[model samples]
Target: MEGMNGRSVRGVEGYTRWSLISLAVGEPVLLWLLLHTLHDGGSALAGPGVAVLAVLVLAHTAACIHAMIAALRRVDPDRGRRGLLPLAATTAAVLVAVVVVLPLDGPAEPVLASIPRASAVAVIGLATIGALSARWPMRILAALTVVVLALVTLTQLGSRIGGIIYLLPAYALVLVSMIASFRLTVWLLEVVRELEVSRESHASLAVAEERLRIARDIHDVVGRGLSVVAVKSELAATLASRGDERAEREMREVRQVAQDSLEQVRTLVSGYRATDLGTELAGARAVLDATGIRVTVTGSADGASPAAQDALGAVVREAVTNVVRHARATWCTLELGAPGGRGAPGVEDGEWCLVVANDGSRGDGAGPGTGVDAVVPGNGLRGLAERLTPLGGTLTTTRSDGVFTLTASVPSRETA
Candidate 1:
């Protein structure tokens, strides 16, 4: 699952280390080659050395093939390890070292012959089939260490330091550790890259899930209340137009309906509000009409995607909210106007905009104000600004004559 440095462990990094072991073991191949070369005692690269070079290069060739397969298995989160061909080529050159630095012990005799001839074929077979293992480090270390130690211990002919039999094992161990460390480091980088990708993916998923949850809650609170308020308000308006005194009684009931809805909306605003333009308009009209404030609205987009419509609706809702709650208005006009209609000159005609204006009454404390009671920064207004900002829109508020006005300019999707 994880490594000492908080890095995820990759099973195939073991194969990469094995390739390095193959490279380090090249020195011994060269030594064996030189010993195998030469006719009698004189120096010559012709004759048997030609054949020795092939065998020396062959082991490195095998290592190259191993590296290639290891490279292909790599999965990258940052940098891809797609081709093992280069690693294979690097390992292959180790065989050439066998040809160059090898001591001429005269004729290729029983040098590498001691290796288990049966397993040699098996190792070659495994490499060709793209087989790999976890115990690869232990296997390579033990096998190569034995071979290198034997060569160093028994063969101290005419060097400055003559006998150093015990030192071979230590040097072999150190060599293996260094090569393994380099490979382990590379693998670690790869693993880290993958983890960072995973973290980003998880974070993005969390944000999307949160948005969906908020949407659901808003629908639950505002959806039912708005529907009921709409039906009752429509009845009140119909009755008032017909000059019926019974309309006044229903109007009282309308007031109760609106107040109950406002209470529920107030509770919701404390938690989260998914107030879009349509819902806010319905709620705003209900609230204002019940308070005897005449409401006028215009320029709303009739048919649009839910998201665009929702965002536009928030503009109206928040504007109407501030007007009803703070403007102390007797009459409020809600306008989802076109861009360039009056305030903005250059834009097109149908660039649907929002303008909510309310004419104030004398000390008209008839409605509850923005929730100063709970001391929470009300989402009713703040949420509106936050939503519109992302769409390159503008929301402005000002007061004129006894009326407070809030206008939101939402550019059409094409221009936006």
Candidate 2:
């Protein structure tokens, strides 16, 4: 008992430290002392009676061990519903052990006085383990355990009510101590398990927060720089058409803006720049809607590969910017969906599709066509394509009837 308490004090696993050690070491040692008491006190069992009692004790010990193991197995979450069978076996064994040691043939089969008390202790200890492993609201089992042990002790000690009064207090103390020890072990195990779960949750939350920070930094660095460059490039084109000297200066400004953006990108990448698909999608809808473009977003970003998510997010950012800065149309649709599914045409299996289309192409500006009628791919579109190529994806642009559409497709893992 001291060793058990000491091991627990030093923080050992509950089921192992308490249940295994107690059943294997504690029960045997206690049983030895109990059997010694029976022998020393002159038990008058002869021949077959002695052999029967020995067998019963062995069986009871085995049953108790099984009960302890079963209790430990169901210590957590399950609350030891599976331990009930072992508990019953152990209880039955204890009762049999009691009957074997009792004076069933009156004075001729008189047993040692200590044998019944020892059996009661064994039964109570098993009951304590059962109580510890069992789920909540086991008041009935607890009451029954106490009543059964008390009755068993009284029946065995027949006409020894004075001895019962003297020994009962010590037996009660033993029972209380057993119960308290088991409860403490169980509580400690729960706390340890909870702490482990909390640690894992904290780690996951930290990773998500870091990802969000990186995404925000990339957005701040890239989005502002790109939007400014677009506006300046448009201004430069207009000035050059009007034969203004400021056109050359505006072109220089555009070059400087591009250089600055390149530097910003390099710095952000060195700091591990990243973006979340969901965040980028939400931002695209907000920016496009504010620019008087009817933005319709469909599908979800869940279950997509991390590489694909990053690529699609970049596409969303670039496509929305192009529509706002260059495309002069009113309606735009963004769809992120599974490929080779309903409403999707020309998309192969194991692929996720991102389609951004706008009917805002200004005829006077660049519109999709060949030679003079063709709209050339800009820096944004080119950069987006570069990002997708490494992820085993393809990007294509089409313009028909003044509608400009950018479609991106990346392979995806099948979900379980």
Candidate 3:
């Protein structure tokens, strides 16, 4: 699941980056072609001048695209500014490209013909670079619009007023759209990265909370008892040094206090090892639901003894963990009760049963005589079997038709 999510994030980032690059390159090419067709009824491919200008425009746009991608990679808002040198070089290259075309000894119509292509390339490059560098999209759009408009107007100074009017709005629209697209893409990537970070942080916090809970429980169990033992042992030593007859009795009481504290600690550890069936079921449901798996729980733990419940709860915990981590199952059913009609031949009456079943089994560990132990050996199903065997419980697993089921049964009449 983690790998799948990571791939999804990287896929989105790659797609967005290339999509922006494609737009940066394609828009100017298409615009130049269209303008060339409209202004002169000749093929855009017919002129050497057109080819040279196309190469220059493509080179400049490629530089801008590279800079934009680099900027996007450094999405952390807290980091120092980056890609500035690339942005500056690309912007300088755009000016150089425009100036190289300015001195062509041609008719005003030819000079004017080249203006829109240069303007389009400049607007796209500047808008993309500004989108990455500027903190605010609107500011970048406004500034890009002014810069592109002035460049176009100066280049077309002796040309038609109508051409300036036509080019200005076109450039403004391109600037607005490019800025908005780049900003939105960057924002989306940032959000995805933050979600991944948040998930990791959430897991860390859960582990920390569990540690704190254990620490608190340990303190409650041993803190006062150990303090009492320390005080009594000191008193006993003092009495013995003064040749008091109560010294032996004081020492015995100190030993008893220490033994009692040890017993209490053992009970605390036992409680940690035992899991509540009801709590485990609820937790399993919540966890599976969060992962988009449907969980159906039936019957109740009320009929089972504490030991039977603990064993079955452990079974549930292991089964649910496997389903989440390996099975890729879409639905799971947890049923706990007497075996009833589902019992095997040797199973007697009055026995509690836990049946955990799910679809989408991977089949690697679901063969005859195999179990989750085959998938995750040593401490998985083998451990569960070891745990249940002491209580006369049996663990069995089977897989068929893309479903895996684990059944555990124990005598509910047995005392804890």
Candidate 4:
């Protein structure tokens, strides 16, 4: 346990120092270490052999100290910590080199203090770079290690082959391991990023789908109930002048319908849906009539496909919604027709078409529907378009002075 604890602490300290060194000066120390390992000890670990090892180790130790200082400054560039790291690293490196290079002082045994110290420092530097950089750079370092070994094995006239024999293979092995580890890390990062993007896209699509669902529900519930209420109220008003008991009953029915409408509206707003074509048409007419606007709905087939009906339904709803909100007109018309030879502009569709038009708003400046704002289809129009697309259909809306129009066209299954 004690041994493990000691190793853990050493590893941590080594990592911290190593990071500092690389930040201070890119790869100089590592380079020097490689150089010395290649050139040092010409089969004799004494004299010049010792000197070479001593210089390499000492230089690395210095680099490590310098790196620590640089890292600290990088983390916090201002204040008193500025020059301290550089100074400390330089002092440490020099002192360490001297201790390692020189033999033990006095009449005892030969001791180079920096041997252990240099090893510790180099380890720290190596670890820090590995920790800080992504895997690609590490792998490159690893693969190039082969080249470095090849360089070592080559003789330069006076250079001896003894040192390269052992150290070259060791360095090559370390390089291979490091490169593989880094490559794995890089692969992992890419995977994580892709996952994150996919998750975000899914979340966005879900939100959009939810909003579409809510809008459809609202159109079904509130739209239908409101239509019924309008019809009953109109019937009651007409009967009021005739002195009929049925008129009073119609008024009560209107009130009941209004209440039902409110409840349905609330339910739809809360994400409930129960849709029917009749209700939607009725709702559209009622809404238009409430504004004293004439409303007309015409379609040839109740036998229309599910897709066609939905497309038609969306057009009517959007037309009503716009006329009620923006057109401010006293008259609106809905026209549905079968697929014909003449294709509608803006829609590449080749099928039946749904057209809803209202007397244009009389407002000064411009009509309620034109330009970019014309495409300013309320959520209903946009949703209709999407729903129609699955049915291989299209919806087109247009507005002229005091006239608002919506067209929903579905390509027949053959064209689709």
Candidate 5:
């Protein structure tokens, strides 16, 4: 995805660069027409004068193309400096060509004189539009229209008002169209670049979020088991010192816990670790009972769909882990049913709900109805919320009196 987005952005940039270069190259064709006109009009300097003019037009075209490439690459920091030579060359060429051809006597003299000047303006405008902002090219175009009209009027001695009127709107329309095309292309290229950056940022965020998920899963899978192992191992050592026969059994239990934790970690890393609600409930009961905390489970996991069961199982695992590690309760109650009975807002009839409530909460400075925010820190419950939210579920926690309650709900297959 990242590579494709980057290539798309680069493609837009390449297309824009070539488009600007094409415009720059094509605009000078008008200068060639001016040369052809001079030759056909039988101007005396058409021989060497045309050659000089041709050289000037070629130089202007080369400079304009170079300026446009530089601007598109954004390599030259001083854009105005980069465009200076092209603008200067075009100005000198236009003045020389116009002055040399002004004395020609023909019905086409005024129109012919205006061609070199107007074409020079267009060439310089295309060049600077690439290097500079749209406003600079617009100013140059405006000046081109004004200069062309004045030259046409002065050359005809104001006797051709019809020609001036005809040329005014036509020149403005052509120049505006060209400038708009260039500006819109550049704008589109910029938008593509921004989209590429945004795509990269989103990819980075996804990576960070995944890392957080793995960390949370490791904690839920391994932390409480390690705590149990430590407690049992210490008791086993004491019982061994006392020559108790049960010490061997406790050590064996520790090994089993370690093995189970190792398997869970492997499965978690492989991304196929699914939690069955019934299995999770049994494990929660066994883990809590081993710690001398009474566990009561209500409601069957049968009616719920696999997705809802998996999500609720994660909630149960994390909640049980928190109860074992963070709370001092003598008892924990696990319940599963429809949230409609509990009057949970926005919960439909077919939604499966899991409630884990324990009395030994250490308070942890969390307030009542704190939802995900007031839960024990470290992405346990928060990660479960992240998991459930995409399934149209919610995770919330509340600390009231001496109990910390975690409630998770998800839609069943029928409702989903």
Candidate 6:
């Protein structure tokens, strides 16, 4: 589930709180068990032994409580070893108490009464440490605990083989359950850590992808604008050298191209610019006309939706930019049409198609074009294709008979 700030909330973050709750509830249960043990088992010991047993029980309880607190702080591996010290103290106290109060000559009732005490020994030592320690160490500690308990139980039961067999299984079962609980809680914490790392990785990937898209957009904007500026400035210089009267007008047009390119670059950097079909057509005509190319545009742009317009406009801009930069031909044609009409045969119905074709794309009758090969798409065409893919459109390029053609088609609906 998402948190208030829109980040995903981790269920595992509640682990420490739940652990405290379990410890709180388990605290009362442990107290009740201790009281019952003292009330019932007190009869088996004298006044001095009873006092010692109480002190031992209290020490063991305190040690277990301390270990549990340390376990919470033991998330760092460096602190885990420090946490184990308290659990070791708890184990020592439990073992000492068990040795002192063990009744070999007592009746079966006193012997049976000692079972709770033995179980407490396991719970206090094994449960706290098992939960905090890494898996391998936890297993080693668990094995040592089981072994010590088996020896203690065997000593108390004496020569009764059947009693030893029955009581050992009960002791093993209790210790195993406590250890398993600890392991499961630790595993849950590991899963939560992994999920947090995965979330961070996904965020980083998203940022990198966005950076790539912006770089592509900037390259398309600046590269096309600069291409036009270069062509117009060169044309102005050529006319000036020939002492023509129109050289001053061509220089003025070059200055205008430079000014427009600057404004477009500023809009692109600020991310407020949107490509429009009308604007692209006007820009294309001006750029091609300045370069002395006959630019003929034949299409009804009003029939296309806003999304189709943007996609087709981007195609037009990029294609026209390529014509100025790479294609050396004297004539360029741009056509727009609804699907399945005589103007756009082989197009699907209810779709809009844009066509940009130029004969100047052929170069030296050897490469794809005369001066530059327009058949091989630059960054502009690739970026245009990328933008169109998500809008259910396709950009296709083909070259034949020294002519390079760029076609872009999209669904007729407006995109939000």
lDDT of each candidate versus the true structure? 0.51, 0.64, 0.68, 0.53, 0.68, 0.64
Report lDDT (Cα) of residue 330, candidate 4: 55
TM-score against native, each model: 0.33, 0.47, 0.71, 0.31, 0.49, 0.48
Task: For candidate 4, write residues 1-416 as lDDT tens digits.
Answer: 11122223344445544433444354445434533443342221246645665555455445444433443331333432344454445445544543354332111111111132222333333433343233224455455444444433432113333434444556456655754654454454345444545555755886899899878877887788888888888888888888878998998888888887887667655433334555678877765654456778776545566556555666666667777676646567766666554444654444776677666555342644443225466677788788777777766665554455666778655333
lDDT of 6 by residue, 5-71 (tens): 1122234545643663364346335634654655665536556765666666556556555555555
Error of 6 at 117 (Å): 5.5
- Choose the strongest candidate by TM-score: 3
Whichever of 3 and 4 has more TM-score, that candidate is 3
Better structure of 1 and 2 per lDDT: 2
In model 1, state the lDDT of residue 78.
Answer: 19
Clashing pairs in 6: 329-360, 361-369, 362-369, 362-370, 363-369, 363-370, 364-370
Whichever of 4 and 5 has more lDDT, that candidate is 5
Relative to the unseen true structure, what is the C-alpha lDDT of residue 280 in candidate 6, on a scale of 0 to 100?
A: 84
Task: For model 1, state the Cα shift of residue 409 in Å.
Answer: 18
Each candidate: RMSD to true structure?
21.1, 22.1, 5.9, 23.0, 19.3, 20.8
Between candidates 4 and 6, the one scoring higher on TM-score is 6
lDDT of 3 by residue, 276-303 (tens): 8888999888777655587899877875
Using TM-score as the measure, name the better of candidate 4 and candidate 5. Answer: 5
Q: Is candidate 1 or candidate 5 better by lDDT?
A: 5
Model 4, global lDDT: 0.53
User: What tens-digit string does per-residue lDDT give for candidate 2 at 312-339?
Assistant: 8889988888887776667789998865
Model 6 regions lying over 4 Å from their true place: 1-10, 16-35, 41-78, 101-111, 114-120, 132-142, 154-163, 223-258, 266-416
In candidate 5, how many Å is residue 351 off? 36
Positional deviation of 59 in candidate 1, in angstroms? 7.7
